[model samples]
Target: MARRRNPFDIFSDFEEMFEEMLREFEKMGPGEHISGPFFYGFSINQRPGEEPEIREFGNIRPERGRIEIGERKPLVDVFDTDKTVQIVAEMPGIEKEDVELNVEGRELEIKASRGDRKYHEFVELPADVDIDTARASYKNGVLDITLNKVEKNKGRKRINVE
Candidate 1:
């Protein structure tokens, strides 16, 4: 009778183990990777030079898919008139001094960061706007932003004469 090899011996070359897994998956079927249920996402945009967080391939619990992470949820409200576009965003725990607003052409950029929490979002205006004329005021845990939209070029009115 042949003696069973120790599992520790199989894991000696950890990196090479992934190749064996790939071969096994290929032999099963192309549908095997996505079909069996358990899945994890890999994001390349994580902080540079930081190793990704990996969880051991353990008991499969589909219920874990419901977990959500990241910064706190943000609330934004935008309204505009002929003269100006107004935006009010509610971001608690963020101070007015921490908020910075920038306008380039018709895009309004709001960046506010405090500690590990940050809120960054861009809003496109109805048309071009003057960045210099735009104003920002943050108070009462709400950011008030106003942008003076650029004046529309006057279109010639056509009239048919008989």
Candidate 2:
């Protein structure tokens, strides 16, 4: 007579199998790059009454110095109002003296450097602004810039119909 197995035994079996799979993945050679938490090159495409197709979908071999998919760009906000244009940027770990701002025509350029880290960004204004009237302030890793818009003359010109 054979001994009966408990239904919960299947869960333990799955746990052991998962642990073994993880161990095998950890033994990957140095040439292999692990980009995700779970199994690599594992994908399943399924359809009703059709066999599932397994395929590899992501970058398995990445080159050195190449930007990763998870890389992030700096956060910036530009607000355009009737009288002024305001720009805000987040630059942590840098002092006010490390930052430089330049405005030419309709463009605003920002540059900052601190030790080994450097940042540069260019923003285009919606309307022509008075660069001389631009005001900027930096506080607690946040930089705020305000530019007064060039005033337009409201005088109407009467054009004779040709």
The prediction achieving the highest lDDT against the true structure is: 2
Candidates in order have lDDT scores of: 0.61, 0.67
Candidate 2 deviant stretches above 4 angstroms:
1-73, 157-162
Instruction: State each candidate's clash count.
Output: 0, 0
Query: lDDT per residue, candidate 1, 1-162, as tens digits?
Result: 976667646343433444544554566665544322232222122245875433222112123223222433345666778888888877666888899888776777777878766666677677677777878888888898887877876988888999
Q: Write the per-residue lDDT of candidate 2 for residues 38-143, one digit (tens) a residue.
A: 2223335566798754432222212242322321123566788999999987767689998899999999888887764455667778889998888999899888
Local lDDT at 72 for model 1: 38
Best by TM-score: 2
Show the colliding residue pairs in model 2.
none
- TM-score per model over all chains: 0.51, 0.54
Clashing pairs in 1: none
